[model samples]
Target: MPRKGMRSVFMKSSSPSPSNSPSRSSTIPPLSPRHTFSESLMEENIEIAQSLITKWDSNSQLSEFSNINSLFNGDRSEARQYLNSVKDLQTAMHYFISHNSSSENLVRAQFLMQTAMKRLEKEFYRILSTNRESLDPESVSSRGSTISSLSDFEEDLEDELRTAGESISEVERVSMAAMADLKAIADCMISSGYGKECVKIYKIIRKSIVDEGLYHLGVEKLSLNQVQKMDWNVLELRIKNWLNAVKIAVKTLFYGERILCDHVFSASASIRESCFTEITKEGAMTLFGFPELVAKCKKSSEKMFRTLDLYEAIINLWPEIESIFSYESNSALRTQAINSLVKLGDAVRTMLTDFESSIQKDSSKTSVPGGGVHPLTRYVMNYITFLGDYSEILADIMADWPLTFQSPLPESYFPSSDDDGPFSAISVRLAWLVLVLLCKLDGKAELYKDVALSYLFLANNLQYVVNKVQSSNIKFLLGDNWVAKHEEKVKQYAANYERMGWSKVFSSLPENPKAEISPEQAKSYFKNFNAAFEEAYRKQTSWIVPDPKLRDELKISVARKLVPLYREYYENHRVGLSRECGSESLVRYAPENLNNYLSDLLYGNGGGGSISSSSSSSSSPSRSHGRHGR
Candidate 1:
């Protein structure tokens, strides 16, 4: 629509001359209004059309193939004027078609417009190609920081350039200039009805950049069959590469490209959106679709951590995915990302189920030597402890995959009510896994021949579990209360081990050490205590507690229970027994000898105490003293 002022100007210029005007020759009949208007419009269009040819006739040598000079590079004002001339010629062509369709001026205008578009097409391609580094997505996106409304974008851009001032580097200046040039050309070409040419060039150049970027990031479009056929080692390396790539892809590469596309084609909303879609859609799909392919591959327990890592990477980058691929055309990219997350979550859940099943199905009947930590105990505890690192993500993934046990776990197995929080699901899941291992361990413990060694096996394995939980991220997921409860179970096992292993020794001691007794009775008591203590020590010489803290605690617990009472009994009965006995060896063990014997237990060193030796002495002075003092 022409403005009212333009309409008035056309009307005035096309107004008919007075019929009786003296300047008009009588033979020259007055012209009709239609004829006069058509002639006036044609003349006006001829002038407008003439401006296009005149403006560019001198610059006609600056063709698409001219490499020495750029139409937009030298003078900012001149470039802007060229755009206005093209716009004016577009308006002229419209008027000519409505008023004088066969006019040569329209042909000229059309030709010049093509000439201008060709020049712009060349500029667009040149700017994109030559300024690759300056106009990279990262630089462009960072300059914008966050997308502002399109209406204020030019203002924001001006403020940015103005603020950069003399401190702007040569690359930054080139980038800003290139951006302005490209946007100007895009706006001019689109207004002149050459948007397809401009957009086609843009898509070709930018899509290449995007494709190359993804290629360098090690993202590839692997089919499910290819991924399935891949060896685990190769697939694992790919997964690690993807884990590192997804962050940069979402945060910088794709994000920056979106910003640049939107900015350059700001004049056309539909063009920018479509261009961004076509440029980034395939690369993004391939990037995000990898996890789903990996999930679809042969599932295994060993691959669970990598699957979880993929899931975590996607979940963490979701905000960027949503923001950058928000276009309706690019919804597939968003859906692909979501689908990868879902598949990864499923893989993780499946791996969890398989792991738990493997634990319960463990059929090893061989008991651990000397009641040491079981291999299954070490494997499962180490695995679950690592699972604790992903507790936050697991909570989300496991929200739907509830723990389903045939029978409820024991109350002691549950974390206290105060331990409940956001990660309760993961905590329960991991806790259930540990419980599965424990039940399996229980079956393994029954294989041991000695009931006392069975208790010791349970204690050693559970102590390992507790230590693993405490040392890793599992400590936070399974709270202090859970740890404390398990620790108490370990204590109970240790206590049972002591009671079952040393019952005879405890029974051999007199009820009251200070009671009056005959020398014969004292000798019998001394003889019985020596036999029981020596037998217990000999039997437990090969037992082991691998954890130093638990080992020391168990030693202290046993020594505290046995040592003082034996010390009192020996002190009261020593002289009377010595008087009755033919040799002093009957009152053989000094109180310090008990401490020495206890030190040798649980070390897995099969050496007996010095009870039979003529000289009974402490081999480890510090260890003996510490045990005695305890």
Candidate 2:
């Protein structure tokens, strides 16, 4: 808990202190026994007279005295002196109370004293009801006690409250003066046509309230009350209005406005200077509070990107804003846009990374595979798609930019002429790879197959371009190993596909009329093709197009292999059953054929009637050389 502001006063009072009575040696100090009794009696009489001032003040001071031992020492001289002082203090307090009876201080003072305070406060309230003028119009409300008593019975109540009030008022005056100055600055900023600076100041004040948690205090109170007593539909309408106001303010300040950088002389000379100073002011600090303010700023930044309107504004301004520090002249605005885009991208990337990490680590049932893909992964994918769409739009806009418009290949948007621009392309490729992996894991092999094929085609074309540009040497050294790794991965996938009964879909026949190969041999063909493609890439010193005819031939070969396998599979499965007679019953079963014969019949015969007559007749058991064995 925080320290109490009044603790020091209590501490000082509790410490040992010298007696108030005069020493015997001092001149005219000690009183005779009779004189002391008389003094005490007079002091008692004075207190009784002052007690009639109000029961509230008397009771409050009595209560205060009960809590402190130092207030009542039981010394006659001390009692006499204390009473005289009490009388004087009460006179002044009464004067003020009578004068400003309708002020908040009166209300507080009356509340402090349970009975007489109430009566006095009630009478003061009555005056307000009857009067035409506002009470204490010239005086602001005080936050502390209105009355001080110095009587021995009320010493604890003589708390220097008036002095405290004066000091507080002084501080308040200074703050008000500063606010006036800020208001002047804001006005000057506006009159001088520094609209952005005005908006900036307004935002600062708005944030001061929010960052201080004052906004939350109000919202919390309002929300609780509404939840308890108000209709939800009505409450929602009010909330909507509040949110709309916030949106409008944000839009007015940031959207389609150049004020942040526009005001030349006034903005540069005054607004920036004043804003920084105001931000550092003690009042600003007090109003905004520390750590909370910083936390609020961080939260608001996150929300700024989350807000759809704010995001759209950013997108719209992307072409017009330069990077905060970028020095490039032509693409300054574009660079700024890039910076903002990168910030948003980084946030998204962080979220995705966190989500991915969670999915990997979470052991919850919801994260289990058959249960569903982790919701975090699904959310990340959605965000990734959003990022992709945003990038696409950005790229389209940038395509018309001066530097990009003249380029023959828009693919230059990728860092490499053959790939995408550095940042965007890399991000996209990584996201694509992750999606493909996820799909494959989920048994959505078909989707992965399509993605893999697209990537492969792109990589191939890029390889071709690299060769054409005589850029193969660097690519060969830096990329060949990576390319080999991809090829190995693809081979593994193709093997898996064949194992899953998809060989007929992915296989190809040899165009060179080679003998029929086993499934293992068929897979080896793809591996060999991959190796040759890599070799061709490594050997190219200059631009050389791989023969298109070779590509087509390979496709045809793959198709032929798949077709033959498909026919054989169908024939084996669909062949008619044969009937046999037993001693007492008839039985039927399928007959197995030689692999070569089946292959030849399926592929060589091509489902046409080209089989030899003898073989055709041999298929019929009745015409065959079946001996009647007993």
Candidate 3:
């Protein structure tokens, strides 16, 4: 090898010049010159090199080169001795180079060094291949603390490297042994100036493991055109895989590879950094770049959820990304990760804008039947509630994104105790999204011919919104005050519903129930009361309050206001009317009958179900208790 010739040349150059040479006849004898003493030392160093390195040399007649494992046969002492010999040979070669470059022993030392490196190269590859399971990314990561705990003992590498192979039963111990063995070989090779060969083998083997790990994780490199042109179902599957893969790739696969690379090549910072970067760069870039590519694809409402999921996964894994890929050389991976987050956040914001605009632009003017919940109301509230579940994630995403309102949002819409608190951006954004839906609902309510049903529709839909906010993570972001404010609005809408819906019923009763009137007058008032009550009941029977709590509250409020007065008037007029003909028909409803009708009031029973006492009065038995799912 060129190193042998270099060693000889270097030894020749180490010799003193004639001007600086010691005089042989002065302090030293002429027969024992300085060159002679140096030559003697060089011979002793050569004898040490030959004793240790010759048997392993391939060209030796006594022994042919073979696999190091077979040569050692699980003999750890032999393996360690072999490494020590390589190191000794390296020392002896340095002695020869600096002292006696012209000596023939330099050639033998050079040959032995080459033979030792080749054997170590084989040993490195063997240990890596055979112990792959023990040294896998997950195993290595799980044992990270344990592996680090082995650091204080790394100087005693012979004990660790001796335990290599299945003989050491524990996975962690085997991994430590394999790592130590690799490090020992690497240090020997690097010291002997064979670092390139050591690094090359590591890159080839570990890169394949990384690629295979990613492959099993279902990560793939695709062009923008390929991703964009793919169907959403297919793209969504890929996005899901990427979401799962990114976390493992960063935490386990890349992380473990980083630890292993750093450990094996710990003797050389430059080699470890370059080796790890080259091994993991391609897979990691492809892994992190997937989200950005998905973000660039066609934008749609359904795709936004998956996009948010992608965004959340990346945001959660970012700290590990920075720590693991912290090397300046791995900046591209870090950049790729951050870019994915940016594009995902941008995509989410755009989706929000598009969603809000779609709600504002909704041209559906048809009134919901019987003033029941509008489809738009259901769709928007359900969507908003689900979005509310992602509040924390959206908070991070929208930290810098302020809502752009043409007019400042109504104080009633988003009432916060602290104005412009930390959550203002996402809070106002999500609240305004709900506000847009409410405004759209207000327009739809106008389509109702009966003003009473319009108010009822508003009450039902707004109650749904309030319940959605109160029940989710949105409560944390928007706060209790916001929920209470919207809840009060629900009550106001309900009050209006009762006022407009029951005004005629209220007016039909006499000014005083106790007033004594002739039988003719009493019968006429009773007739009017019956007609008004029936009309109001018929009009309101189909209107719905989907929320059970709001439904019950509205029932109690209406009953509280109207039932007592009607019951008192009914008692006052009943005896007088009874004396006249057909009193039961004139006073068609008892007080209990009115309460029963109110009980069934907001069940959304279609086609204005009968107000008669015979109709079922219980709340809708079939309505799902799961408010959002309903």
Candidate 4:
């Protein structure tokens, strides 16, 4: 009676009755687990189960929890163990419920499966809760709660579970659930001001995870400084270990959610809290103050090596500090790390500026307890040297930025760069910092009461900074153009010094034979030359230049400019000049003498020269660049 199309459809769509299907027939060979219900049979079973309810019978089909043909057992412990032992519990339950069972029986199977999962979940949490209670603050402290100690404790506790006949995996599953619970507890402990205890558990998890094999991933939770004076090596090792644990927890707990579809308490986010201490309640957003600690350490170190200034000693240290920032693989955490560094840099800049401005508040404010170099100059040098130290570190920080970045320098932190120079954004930033320090130095130099000494100090320090930058790796960061420009500034300072300090001597030199001087004027000229030459030479011989090459270059520069003209003027008019002051006595420097004079230009001389320091020469001690030579 069926239509032709309906008959064809029925033949194709219908599955054989349970008695007729090849798989269902007792005569057929068993499907060795790999064989499964066809799609239609699975759909038919799920559809039947969705439409009815069956008895929650604890006997008959539910009587065993063994092989596939075995039924579920009634004992709760055994049922709980049954759920725990299966590698794919959900898959097993789904297959059992949807393969040829009546709809009502399939529903009953899902209910029993869920019941077993809940029982196991409850038992797991119960055991771990007891373990946590036993690890109260006093107990944790007594054991000294190291990662290894906690690890040993975890092992021993889980061993007890194994002794109770739980599988190794079942104990671990329970422990993982406990660890998940510990995350919230740790967060609460931290939030409630029991951060120290939270740290203990954090270490426990971290150390526990090392064998878990994860930090071929990366992971800070602290004002890194608060613990700086602590044994950082041990703390660092623990941090690395803790990072591994977090990766494992995140992955594993995520697995629990996917496989068991249970309320797996993931502590992965809270795991971060255990890594570092925080100043505020903002959790992981706390800027790790380690980078700032590093910045401060460099500033402190500058006091020990004051003469060399800032950058030389500090540059080597940046690598270690920057590594702290780089170690945090989490992008959000790294941003906090960078903010801490920027805060440090800004703080340092403020320090330098405040120091300089305070000096200016009353130039007569007592000098700090150090020798020779003026306190103001020392302050400027420290800033220059220390900032020079910071320059490369900042450049390194900036190096991660795009080369095309045109972002302005961070507030009070970055240095000036030569826009015209071929350098990266980082390079430009370094240049800007250098320029800022130099500008401050130049301003301080201007404050010197003696116009000539101002030029001299400025010239020495500027040349020193330029040479330091050029000789170090910072040179490339600053570019050749920056060096050249600053070198020109050094020269400009020297030129100013020359015009202001030496012009009188050059003026006193005799001119053309056509312009005859009266006897009074000639005598006056000789007297003036004696006064000027002796004064300049005596004042500078004892001032320290420090660097040999800089010393030589300045000496050569003086000779190149002074020797030729002095010789020309002396030769042209010596015969016409007065001998009243005595030519030998009047001429304090011969051409050869000039060579010795200039060679000792940068270093302070101990008044060692052929030039006489007669009663005519000023007796005042020249204290501009002290004899603190290296």
Candidate 5:
């Protein structure tokens, strides 16, 4: 609306002027000639200038001068009002111009308005400079309003009025000068025991500056061309600067009234909220690129389990996270803080999930006496301990929130199937990680295929798991009874070793032969015994028994079960089974020789365990043959 009237006035003013007009020639009065009219117009200009100054000083005629003040103050609603009195005056001037009405008076009138406006502007600046004491922070509170330190102050200027350059610039220049003038005011306020007022004034000024900066960062409207041309990185960097500015303000020294301190603090909070709102509402969240960060975690762990840099990243962001709320007695802010933490928790969970997904589940489960555990399992186990070690930090973060919470938040999302036994959500999350790692190890154990070696492998890994869990924070999660259960499970695998490996060897020996037994039956018994003993020996000697104690115990058990059965059978059948092969040949092994062979099977002796066949078919089954001690 202002543009429409201004447009007409501007157009009227654009046409070239003449010194005198024909229309005035016929109507000229007796004494009042063209020169008199010229003098009257020049006087009129001076009168208008004096009236404008009067209105400015009086604060009267606000309604009449609404557009003029609004244009300067940047009040869009008032600035947009259609021009009123100025319109009628310009309309009359337009009529004179259309009839070739310019005379010397019109020329001076034109020059007069410019001269008056310039002079008025000069005095406006002087008065502002003169009243600088009122802008002082001490006087600021007593004065009606705060003069903010603002950015983009001239950005909202009306397009039509941009040509009104001298008037517009002068006003803005004065406002900025007021701020500079206020600096001495600020120092004066401080030196004169008004530090509290100084801080309060600083708060109002900083808010306007921050709010304007924020406007451009995300909230301000832009043409489609502007949007397309925007460099997204530049926008994000600006937002970061605002956030940093707020942080600096929070840490800024403020020895002032609590009210002023509260204001500075509140202003800082509002800026954070605004920046975060931009992130959430405008999808500026991509600025943070959380998914990409999580991907880095995945890549790191995938490269090597020891590259757990996510922990450091979390630590680095703690201060940002810490500054989210005041945590002073406001329940709503406390609630807000909790909600923010939940969002942060989601981020942490993403990093952890990346870690989990990257682990090579098919990797081996090796645990020797000193070291052999999988790195992921070690990392997972140690990380769980780390969580426990710092759980209090998390607790402190949520402590205020919990007091106002209606129901507790879920600690994890593992979604357990067992309904009866309730575990802490944190415990479940950790357990899931540990068990997934163990499942990977279990797959590796099956690779051995040998029943005894598979059992040995499983035993070693499970033992390591149980021992580490029991000694650390994990003990609380996995209960004390879990160790005994796992130990018993390991023993079952060992029991399987006895049944599959050694029981068949014992089956070959039988009770003593009766007197009625025929020679053929006795020879059959002796031949069967020789075949079974040699078969079991060759198969088992090369098997690894990493535990030396277990290896010795197995050997002793086999010896105790077999020796007596052979001794009883030897007295009854020795004479009969002997004659077929010479007594020497019949003695594949004497009782004592059998004892020695079982004792040495995979014993600690360092030779690569191959049982060589050394037959003595001609030797008698007697003391001399047995005593050879081979």
Candidate 6:
């Protein structure tokens, strides 16, 4: 029979045993004195507690007895304390296992165990493989042994089939409760539009449970059947929550005070790639049409561009961006994308300049603007200008110069024939005239004259051949009608110039000189004329013509001759006006008007020399004559 005092504490009540329960005992031990425990007596109490713990099918009942024994064993306090601690830990572990034994918890526990084991193994290996010679082998071995003992304890717990089975059932119940609680919280969060927060809480709960159960157990393969049984809708909801979290993170980064712009830039680059893929896959054409989304993207991208420090990154990414320009199905998108790319380029240039300026100014030197203007910008500007100038020249050649030559030559003109035959001669003359006009306009009239004279010689030879061809009835075919048409255009252009006031300048040239001009006088006049022509040409020519050796040589000679005359003109017009107007007025007006008047004198209507002669002597005689003929 059970002892009177021990009956309530140690004796079990009649109850149905769990399936696969351990053998039960009918007799109970007598109670010891409450006070006064000797070492031997304490040892006996510890043994009794161990024996009871070993017999009990349920860990909770075993743990209760162990705690009571610990209170009674006062003399073997340390040993009993260690035993009780182990038992308590084992009981707590059992409770947790029982409450969390759903498939989800099992799977999560296994994963957690694996992760912890990996970390432990890594740390163990790191310590074992360390280079320190002072490491104590005994200490390492003791730690290893402790780990092995814990592993064995977990094995023993697993081997207790009835206890393990009961714990598993309890774990399932607890897991279900936990899942319901989690679901309720998640639903609340979803209703409140705090889905991201819910996801975070759920993650923390899962991790805490998993870490607590599996990290110290070192069990690698726990059951996950219950987890597998959970509704997929939960997972889907979690994923949606995760997506919301990502959106929240992006917004936080964008609005945060930190220079998180670099992160945003990286995010934007990723978003472009990812979202573009979605657009393609989902056939979401309307998404591209959304202006607000596009504007947001553009603003984000611009901000990103502004923050980028690396020029190489810009260059590397520019090609990918350029490819987007070809995707023009959505005009608005295309425009925004293109403009963003342009802004990026500008930003890159700005960054490059800033970086270079920093380098240069390191020693306290001033930096120049346009010093680091990108080669690409320069190339684009030059190409645009060239195209524009070429187009203007084409228009002028087609429309203006040739028509004036259609009227019959006046009787006063020498070599006057019935018809100026095919108008080719007149065209050549007119072209020369146009060239002369250009030189005058350029303030390089003297240089134009020399060049024109050379071209005229060439034209004269060509004309003599044409005459020969006509007289011989050879019917030589000129390659294209460009020459005739170009000449007519030149003539009309010259006539237009006359109407515009060039005739007055032409009338000012020395006419019908009685004496043969001295070589020195001719040279001096040519020199002055050429100098004026070049200056005017540089100022006025819209389309640049490559300077030939002959033109350059003529220019030098003209410059030498005209230096004195220019000085005289400058002295009389500029210096004299400055003296009259005061230095301040001269300074104010000189930058604009002085150069302009000089340009006019050299190229304008009534300059003393003919610019047409210079063009006539050059390769294209007709253009030369037409330039200055009027």
Best by lDDT: 1
Query: Which residue ranges in model 2 land beyond 4 Å of their true spot?
Result: 1-349, 362-380, 392-429, 432-495, 500-579, 582-630
- What's the TM-score of each model vs. the native? 0.87, 0.26, 0.88, 0.43, 0.39, 0.19
Ranking by lDDT: 1, 3, 4, 5, 2, 6
Tens digits of per-residue lDDT, candidate 4, 97-153, equal: 444333454465466444433333333334334554333222322223222222211
Candidate 6 wrong stretches, greater than 4 Å: 1-292, 295-630
For candidate 5, the per-residue lDDT at 124 reads 31
Q: Rate the local accuracy (lDDT) of all candidates.
A: 0.79, 0.33, 0.77, 0.45, 0.44, 0.31
In model 3, the runs with Cα more than 4 Å from the true position are 1-41, 64-73, 149-168, 417-421, 606-630
lDDT of 5 by residue, 341-414 (tens): 34444445554566666554445444332122445555666666665443433333233331222655332222
Candidate 5 local Cα displacement, residue 515, angstroms: 10
Cα error of candidate 1 at position 369, Å: 2.0
The ten-residue window of minimal lDDT in model 5 covers 250-259
Global CA lDDT computed for model 2: 0.33
- Candidate 3's error at 579, in angstroms? 3.1
Candidate 5 clashing pairs, residues 3+ apart or interchain: 583-619, 583-620, 583-621, 584-619, 584-620, 585-617
Q: Compute the lDDT of residue 530 as modeled in candidate 2.
A: 32
TM-score of 6: 0.19
Please give the distance, in angstroms, between residue 63's alpha carbon in candidate 4 and its true position after superposition.
18
Looking at model 6, report the run of 10 residues with the lowest lDDT sum: 253-262
Model 5 Cα displacement at 411 (Å)? 22
